[model samples]
Target: MNDLVLTGDRPTGPLHLGHYFGSLANRVRLQERFPMYVLIADYQVITDRDVPGEIRRHTTELLLDYLAVGIDPAKVTIFQHSAIPELNQLLLPFLSLVSVAELRRNPTVKDEIAHSSQSAVSGLMFTYPVHQAADILFCKGTLVPVGRDQLPHVEVTRLVARRFNERYGEVFPLPEALLGEQPLLRGLDGGKMSKSRGNAIPLSATEDETAALIRRAVTDPDRVITYDEERRPGVAGLLTLAGLCLGRSPGELAEEIGDGGAATLKRVTTEAVNEFLRPIRKRRAELGAGDVRRILAEGNARARERAVRTLEEVRVAMGF
Candidate 1:
């Protein structure tokens, strides 16, 4: 079988600029070159939260964002995580391959637990990396598109694949990380970009909303604009956003806007981001919930076919 692209987002909220620079942009580029599968990690959304929240609504919005951003359902297989039971079933055997101690060692998992406000960590959240493995291996996915922070999670997936093949038989291809070309787009406050923190700009935001959000970005109190990532990450981040949208270098953009300060920087960045999202927002407006559901239904059927076949192989490998 040929290498398949498997990558996805947790359907917790609308995607943001970080999502675009990190994975969505790459997915649009790779869809033409390879058979890509975009997963809506619906189950993973509950890994940390107490309630499922508006999963159905959030999942639909995520799908709409995918299409609006040019991830065509005709070419890319977009499937929901919970819809495929066989795929989740792989977690049982895959989980057995990993140790609780080993799970504790995953840096991403540790970071997530630390970030979560609740004192207790959910079992599903603790074993998140193994669930990630099941997400990739069940589809025989060999190329996973991810940001820098997600690399460790993929490493855990690779480990499970290697160990399972050793014992159960050669059932999975060791997947490789296709890192995003951009640097980490930190939150407006120079921390993680999350909606809960009120530091994200959703792709579906209007020009006014975009402008309003940028207005609150945390920049150092210097009245000059320069791209100093170490000392001025917040200002530098705004520059990066403008650069990505305008197709220019952040340093170059900073030089052009010398002494422009946070006001000018935010204005320029807002203009750039809104201009970049205009077409995407228009496309998003044209998408309907009906279309989203139909596309997912089709994708789920296709994904189940692939997952069922993989599980059949696993059973045979173990002489079940």
Candidate 2:
């Protein structure tokens, strides 16, 4: 069998279009070819001191988004990170292999700290890369599907795996990143698409909600619509979104909408987006709470089985 593939998302909010185009779509294809493990990274959410109530509520929402996007639990093992205690046990040994200064210097961690509203960084926040390493290695993950920005986190996982094997003899396989061809979709405000920014259109969003969000999306003040990301990010973002929905190039969409103006662009974009999301929203509405609970229960059990085996091997190798 091919090396196992591992990836996940923090259940902070409902999954959005950025996630659908960026990774979720790729995951739907990958699960058919590889032994894949998709994690609901609940533990990682608390790194920023998020309330437990919110995490619990959003976890269910995130799962529904996964199913709505066609992430079949039968094909991919969708598991909760915190459900596997062995994953936490692996974190201690992995943390020892890396230094504090190195963790502080991780670009991804630094970016999170800079953008966060917190005045002070939590130790959990600082050490999340270690936790992520644990999440991957606990599954013996040899291939990690991630975005370009997340390459650094995967690199840290490789470093941890290499150091552990060097000191204790070979055990973990160093995981490589598989980046998707899809471009990173920007938020409605022409920035990173995040729920915290209130700029994302959730996969579960109604047709009216999607239309309202796209109507208010930032666009170039100039009359004509064009696709120049460097000079006119707002217009370019709308074009990119429309292209993703309609299966055309942003440049092609730009030319098609030439001299149509921002109002025209927004109108086309709103229609394209709502049309694209119509089916996903319908499927999500069809899923009952019982369906989500049953999926999680089965996934958590399968994940624990793999995690336990990996942890036992690590313990013996480390003479613990």
Candidate 3:
């Protein structure tokens, strides 16, 4: 079987530092090693229905961020999820492979419910992992690169594939999780780096804007220079940010700042982050709207061709 890697981001907002440090930077390397499919999950964006305009603009903006961050159009297939109907169609049968109780137990769903803090959760939100399973299994993905929080989705995809093979003939390979080692990066306010929280530093933000965000980023309130995440989450957060951006270790940074103040750590963290983003910012600006549009158009064509082929197989298998 061919080694295929599937990964993507929800186009709910501009790609941010959390995305960059968490997984996007890793994709630059993985794309060279595996047959990578970078999906722009626009359909998933509608899970929260209030942000239609944000989703539309972000879909295009995400394409720009991918281009700016060295996601080569020639090396990887970049596709919008909504543009591929076959995958969505697969969600119907695939949904039956797993139980509603199983879905409720999924950590991802639980986290989303808690994050939204809403009593009314949409069916789309509840069933998203099954849809994601369809997305991966439809493409016959063998390797899924994701952070630890996403491990549950990969687990569910594996379960769905196993069940589908047992119910029908063997139709899909169980995909494995390629988990990252770094701790989950947090937003400026010490929460997760989320656009909804308004604490994210957009991958497309200017150097000045990025610096400004870092300045406001929550740091150790104790005003001490130590890097104790348990005692000083804010300073520890900055250390994590710097380490992730500079490709250094947080422990090393902690030792380096023997007697420095929180201001020093902040300054150093800001500089490290800005320096890291300099190239991407320049490329993001250089990637004009017309160029981004053309890339997505080509990506859409390539994606549809593959989706059509996969749907043909599904139809034949199920006697559709």
Score every model by TM-score.
0.93, 0.95, 0.91
Model 3: runs farther than 4 Å from truth?
117-119, 220-224, 254-258
Of candidate 3, the 10-residue stretch with the lowest lDDT total is 45-54
Error of 2 at 27 (Å): 0.6
lDDT of each: 0.89, 0.89, 0.83
Best prediction by TM-score: 2
**Which digits, one per residue and each the tens of the lDDT, describe model 3 over residues 160-249?**
889877777787898999987656677787777777889888887777887788888777545446667677766777888898888898
> Candidate 1 clashing pairs?
none
List model 1 lDDT by residue over 1-320, tens digit each: 79899988888788898888877888899999999889999988878877778999999989988999999999989999999999778999899999999999888998998887555788988789999999999988999987788899899999999999999778899999987676677777877676777788998899999999899999988987889989998998899889988999999999998997889999999999999999999999998878988999999999999999999998888788
Better of 1 and 3 by TM-score: 1
Rank ordering of all candidates by TM-score, starting from the highest: 2, 1, 3
lDDT assessment of candidate 3: 0.83
Task: TM-score for candidate 3, please give it.
Answer: 0.91
